[model samples]
Target: MVAGEPFRMLVDPLATGHCDQWLDLPETSRAGDAAALLDLLFGTDDTLDLVVLRVGTVRHGTASRRLLRGGAKGIDDAAGQTLPGHPRYELIDWRCPVCQTLVWRIHADPRRPPECPEGCGPMGMRRTG
Candidate 1:
């Protein structure tokens, strides 16, 4: 590198910029259709054992196979919960699959999973640092 010398790094705007197809824009963040949302909210339509435990026992009642759609607000509320020492729970906003409505809030706890507001089932989670 020389003093006052111009250096350039080749970068593809579409691949590196905000316009990247893989980058989910704010407007296009929602799942393409309700079916996808349902899949995300609940694992699958098929019945299976789903559980969240504090130690070795179930924390909340098991969610029976059902469909829940509507009251996006309720779902949002269910998503956010307060912990003793942790920072305020942050959730990704999403559109309800059953209702196609905006959800301002939603979260999932590793120790205690969130119940489906519309009775869809239980919300899944991913570990965040």
Candidate 2:
């Protein structure tokens, strides 16, 4: 799937902390309930970076600090920890330049630039109405 497409993601609260509740969130829920859930799970936003890692048929976006700390290699490590017998997974990190929006998809291709949802041009033109 291309970036900016709406998708559902399963969150493992326990991965970030000792929580019994698991969250399944829609794309729109990312900044609202999902953000709150991440805060609760990770305890700090510093380590709450969203990384979409695919394992078999399931694609999950887990909160990880590896990306911020370890960069590309860290992403590989984070994917490895998600499931057994896998060495690495694809990473989606595309964001809209105009609005600074994180673009997400079930299977994201980073090569594809995300379109601004607010219709902001490449120059970030704002709507007057």
Candidate 3:
């Protein structure tokens, strides 16, 4: 650690607030939507203080916010309302970084951390355009 260097805690939009658990905010939205959300919520700020003090601070990120404001009508109404391309259930394949081998495929909740069969723990994969 360096002296005078500020500490920061970074979390995706979902962690900051469970995206799917909210009304009309589908958990299966596209990655671009999530990126847009992160942009709107945490566009730019300082290390001294964060604009979002709590969960409800940044719920108005245009599209999703509009949905939230509309409120969830009912279980039936919200049923099958996920993003067009997103499947109701998505699988995530975790891999071992050291061995560069595929590991296990599981749900994308992320609350459940996946481990490498070879004890490599978890590694982040770079996204390629």
Candidate 4:
């Protein structure tokens, strides 16, 4: 998937949260470029409270379904240890650049950051309170 293409993201919150959130790919980067996507999402953080369940282009809902199935297979392969819900794991919180929405807390370990729930694009690191 390329940048600007509609993509869905499946995410699980840090603490006792279930269900997946579908979001578009950030305008600034392409989906095939995992590094750029990760940087856009996570910023400088190395860890994240939310875990990426799956990411894929949106085309007649087939891509998302395929990704979901793959994610499920991965979970099964992990011996059911990598379930969607996990306990609280704190990370630095960031605010959305456009809407000022509080984004998910992220760890110092690099990973994909959460997009704005408002569909504003990938969130940037909040510089101030």
- Best model per lDDT: 4
Q: Please give, for residues 65-126, the per-residue lDDT of candidate 4 as tens digits.
A: 22333343322332223222223223355667787666434243245766666678887765
Distance (Å) between predicted and true CA of 110, model 4?
6.0
TM-score of 2: 0.27
Q: Distance from true position, residue 85, model 1, in Å?
A: 28
Show the colliding residue pairs in model 3. none
Location of the lowest summed lDDT over 10 successive residues in candidate 2: 84-93
Q: Give the per-residue Cα lDDT of candidate 1 at 111.
A: 32
Best by TM-score: 4
Model 4 vs. true fold: TM: 0.28
lDDT of 3: 0.30
Candidates 1 and 4, the one with greater lDDT: 4
For each predicted model, how many residue pairs clash, with residues at least 3 apart or on different chains? 2, 0, 0, 11
Name the runs in model 4 displaced over 4 angstroms.
1-88, 106-110, 127-129
TM-score of each: 0.18, 0.27, 0.25, 0.28
> What TM-score should be assigned to candidate 3?
0.25
Can you give the lDDT of residue 91 in candidate 1? 40
The TM-score that candidate 1 achieves is 0.18
Off-target runs (Cα >4 Å) in candidate 3 are: 1-86, 104-107, 110-112, 126-129
Per-residue alpha-carbon lDDT of candidate 3 for residues 39-117, written as tens digits (9 for 90 to 100) = 2332221221112211111232222332322242322133234433344343343445676544222234544443433
lDDT of 1 by residue, 1-129 (tens): 221111001111122212100111122222221122332334432442221101122111222223222222223333223222234323444333443322223233233443334445544433321
Candidates ranked, most accurate by TM-score first: 4, 2, 3, 1
**Higher lDDT: candidate 2 or 3?**
2
